[model samples]
Target: MAQSFQFETSTERYRDEHFLPYFRNGVTRGPMTAETSDIDGLADRSRTPPTVAVVDAQSPGNVGTIARAMKNFGFDELLLVDPPALDPDGEAYGFAGHAREDILPNATEVSFDHLVENYHTIGCTAVTNEDDHSHVRFPYSTPSELPDRLATVEAPTALVFGRERVGLTNDELARIDEICSIPAAADYPVLNLGQAATITLYELRSLTLTDEETQLPDLERVRAPEPTIDRVYDQWAELLEELNHPVEKREKTMRMLRRVYGRADLTTGEAIALLGLLRRATERPAEQ
Candidate 1:
């Protein structure tokens, strides 16, 4: 049977004690919004290159705002991999202003793997330090380095982002070169996806100062290698069959592990380390 909604008998008292004053004072329940005035003069376009992609973006407004930001910062190619929803003529366009008409229609949509495959280099952003993020460059080097990197970077550089609710998945995390993160106050570290992308692009634009700065002389145009996930417990599949561990139990354990590691935003290096740990653990004989 379907569950039915339940009403509290003390609702009137609860509201009087709790919600009444807040409502009367014009306070409402919702997420905080960052306040800012006009951004026309402040938006910089020279920092970003022609190749950038946002993956699995969940919000329609976020998608449009990010596209608008890309246009503001002189970025051309925008890829959306299985986005949650999009509104071409909604608030996104309102924020986009002139760029909306051009970008919203032509923005490319592709499978996540296909987008990663096309990019010469791919990078991701994360908030926490996991094994994959052990090598963090303080002050965030991507912005400073992007101009030089761009001069020599080949077509299609993937900038993988995550869902608003949870960020990127482990499978997605494994597909990028490095996991980039903004060092914010510990009290409020996670940034909204659109804001993070916008800031990152702006920082990269800031670095495009001079001809000397823009030239990365020796960097070669090598294709970014694809990232892969090797489930260590695949071996456990056979062991579960042999030892008769319940299928549901094995699956639950695997899913929980995947979620934990996924949240860490594992980069290629960290994934390797984690896989090594798993390999060692799996090599031992099953408990009696």
Candidate 2:
């Protein structure tokens, strides 16, 4: 036999508080549109969409605007450090426009050091430091040059922005691996915090994920085996010895030779062909 249970208190109040109501299309309680994460598509990309880090921002509105810029350029991850007081109904969300739900609500608060330890930090600056000093450095690549440069990076990257008044400190700049400055004319230079972020994201738009529609290559050749490369090196060493090359310089020469071949990323067939040519060249000594 089963026992029946009854609740004396009303459960109707809980429906509107937590669950989606059966009939009402309430603005505040309505279904929120979410960004669909395309994991498979992201895997094909060489680099991830950079996490935007705002350091010591004085205004909440600026943060929201930055998040809006990120959504426009297909970036989602945001990191805030020493930010101003944020209010849901404040100008922060108002400035966010449509990206309010996408970026601001999900924004992460993290320490500046945490971003340094995890992702490759790209320091954003308007000032160009054209020096060879260890502490002071020029950008590794300009905005237009970033596509080619960042294409080879297969790791997580972050773009760090500083406060409105004074940009990133010298200590912060020194620790950064790379720095990027938006090229501006001398007559009317220096854009605002939001402008710089928007421009940077526009230039780096290629790194963002897209629809999984890119076709794969038909055939892919594997690299030459380690043994094949070692054998080729051994043969080259024997040829160098037979030529009476300077013994003192041979080791350095061999290392350079290794780098030359390594850059080729030779296949087994190509390695064998190169090894055969070395044998022929060694067999004939000056044709004397």
Candidate 3:
């Protein structure tokens, strides 16, 4: 049996009772009209990424996994509609990893209509129409394309996913402003709820994360300096000479060593260690 959908008529009461308090601390939600400009400037305003909303998610563990994925991609605000009970010591918290501390605990419960009224809702679905004849799911954007498409909009947005089994019904998709689908093999395009959210969040990471925030190690700080690298090459040459490498092959061997080192992207410490080992090898007497 298909689930019935209804739009909530009392918007202000719902917003006041359920929505406003969750955002009072730091999350901002309001209409972003043309005349309304953020006092912090557009760049700062655009930094606010889309909220992640799961509609009628069945499993607490899946919800937790989605929360974990949200943390991985720098998104914090999560909205749930008919979600499972996330006990402190339950699978939801266990699977949430670091997200249990913030994302899962702070997730707000909202009605589907609250999302429609308060946000530019983008429905994520595996099933899409093949042609423009049906507007409900046609003209959908892939997850990778969302960043450029949503770059300038300052309004609050929501990436809405539906139930694990049926997903969002036709009626719900019809009400959503936009649709986003992940491209997959024709035989099976559907993904696990957590997987779908993770992939979509990853593709949209550029919207929420900065270059400094995403990089693992500061490349400039770790890369070996030019002089240090030169010393490594010099040490290699000295070691080769000490070993009495073939005269004709020495230059080629040195060139090969340079290529290998160039591709290694060795850190300053690694270069120094290599230089030390080479120096010791060059100075050590051959075994009699």
Question: What's each prediction's clash count?
Answer: 4, 0, 0
Q: What is the lDDT of residue 181 in candidate 2?
A: 84
Model 3 scores what on Cα lDDT?
A: 0.83
Per residue, candidate 3 scores C-alpha lDDT tens digits across 92-179 of: 9999999999999999998887777777789999999999998899889999999997775545678999999989999989888889
What CA root-mean-square deviation does each model show from the true structure?
24.8, 16.0, 7.6
lDDT of 1 at 12: 59
lDDT ranking, best first: 3, 2, 1
lDDT of 1 by residue, 74-94 (tens): 665667778655565566666
Clashing pairs in 2: none
What 10-residue stretch in candidate 3 is worst by lDDT? Answer: 1-10
Candidate 1 deviant stretches above 4 angstroms: 1-48, 128-142, 206-288
Q: Rate the local accuracy (lDDT) of all candidates.
A: 0.56, 0.73, 0.83
- TM-scores for candidates 1 onward, in order: 0.49, 0.56, 0.73
| Poorest 10 consecutive residues by lDDT, candidate 2 | 1-10
